[model samples]
Target: MELTLKGLHHVSAITAKAPENFKFYTEVLGLRLIKKTVNQDDISVYHLFYGDEKGNPGTELTFFEIPMAGHNQDGNNSISALSLRVPSDEALAYWDQRLTEHKVEHGTITELGGRQTLSFRDHEGQRFILVSDENDKGVAGGTPWAKSPVPAEYGIVGLGPAHLTVETAEDTAVVLEGLLGFRRKGTYPSTAAGQPDVIVFETGEGGSGTEVHLEERNNLPQEHLGRGGVHHVAFRVDNEEELKQWIERVRTVRLPNSGFVDRFYFRSLYFREPNGILFELATDGPGFATDEHIEHLGESLALPPFLESKRQQIEAHLKPLDTRP
Candidate 1:
């Protein structure tokens, strides 16, 4: 069967503080809070989602807020950075000024794969890049949030190339190429000395959100999953039938995957790549508006049918979060 993974569906991370995470992504970064939900697997933790106005698949960046969690270690076998697409070089400059005015720590603009990028870390030290794609190949476009502090023209487009740090790229390359339909695009010099070259992989089409860069760090220590670290990076699949095909493909390749799991908003199949980073293949249907009306999204806590019985108990344990922009 052919693989139809288009681009990123969402990049989910862990945050140690709920209030700070809520403010940083919604206010500082200017993304809309699309869903206020709890982690179905662990109801005590809050699973908050932020994205474009309509909660489009590629625009999403979610979080599992757990105040007790510790800091994450920087090492191999992890997603080190997430790149967000912007419209042009002007947008990059706008972000530089905006971040500085807000007292956010960010680096000056730099070039990566011929594109201008501004690197910054969130309050919890999760790295991110604001990249300009004037050609519009990588990030098609999306609806801007009506209440965002950043203007629509310069707002974030969507999730772009995400950096995956691994000890060796050989086995992971096979999964990306053979099973996931990603092709080897090109190579770039590693940022760290003595590290293996960084390999670029393109899925569907060779554009911004469709690229994934793998950096092989052979001598680095294994990383522990905790706060400020990526929990999983989900790739976009069109619907249920396409999602089913992927499950069968995973079985044929003998990769251990969590067979179809319905996440009320979308269905998902979770698995780990050879290098140990959790990867998810999620469908793009019944999106954030399935339960609540479009105008009222993220205003209240939402729960799937199975968790309805425990809503009261869950709500009691989870702290109240004010998601105002």
Candidate 2:
């Protein structure tokens, strides 16, 4: 069967402090706390998800909390930065002032790939760029949560282009093109001195939400993962059958992968491209609404069926988390 990746599913990153992370993402950023769950593999720790109104597929930005994690040491072969989509070019001005009022470290508004953007780092140095969806045409953005601190017009709508830094750009390019079916979109000048222009790639319904910007730097060392570093980036598959087909496609290409992981909200397959950057293909449905009603998402700890049996033990290990929203 012919297949095309729908768009970005979600981007998972690491956070050492779950409580503080929650406050920043929810109160400060105006994103909705859609899920309060534990990392499936490490039930003692948290896996928090933030997004627009209902935590739709492309809108999710998740974080796995590791209390003792070290600071991230950035370099090549890493998901260097992530972009969040805002409604228009003018919104950049609003965010610039909002971020300043909150004392969040950020850059002045600038242009990248013909779109206005504002770069910033969270308390833990998690890098992000707010990309304006001013004239964007594909993969429509999500609806901002009605109760967000920021007004709907200025709230973040969804995930945008993820930036990847690699040493051998061609190796990663091959996987993006041949294996993942992404096409070269264009290029933009690199912010770093003496570095080559970053290459852009996109998949289905090409737009900010469906793109990846690849930056190649040969002189840098590999990144050492820790707090504030991205764990993986996932692309969207339409359903379980399609996810299974994608699983087979990954295996057929001889890439070692996590076969079929049923994440409850979505089913997925995990793999790594040649540069050791983790990638995942996830489905869009059997979504967060599967276990909890949309109205009460993130209000309490949510356990998948398999973990329900250990709820007592799991709750005992986790610190008190107030996900009031």
Positional deviation of residue 185's Cα in model 1 after best superposition, in angstroms? 1.4
What is candidate 2's lDDT per residue for 223-286, written digit by digit as tens? 9999989999999999999888888888999999999998888998999999999999999988
Best by TM-score: 2
Supply the TM-score for candidate 2.
Answer: 0.99
Model 2 ranges off by over 4 Å: none
Query: What TM-score would you give candidate 1 relative to the actual structure?
Result: 0.97
Candidate 1 contains a number of clashing pairs equal to 1
Report how far off residue 89 is in candidate 2 (Å): 1.0
lDDT of 1 by residue, 1-325 (tens): 5667888889999998888888888888898889999988889999999889989998999999878888988888999899898889999999999999989889999987667999998888888989898765753756778888889899997888989999888888988988898988898888789777789898865687878899988788998878878898999898999999999989988989899999989999999999988999999887999998888889889898878999899989988887643
Clashing pairs in 1: 138-208
**What C-alpha lDDT does candidate 1 achieve relative to the native structure?**
0.88
Model 1 stretches astray by more than 4 angstroms: none
Question: Any idea how many clashes model 2 has?
Answer: 0
Alpha-carbon deviation at 223 in model 2, angstroms:
0.5
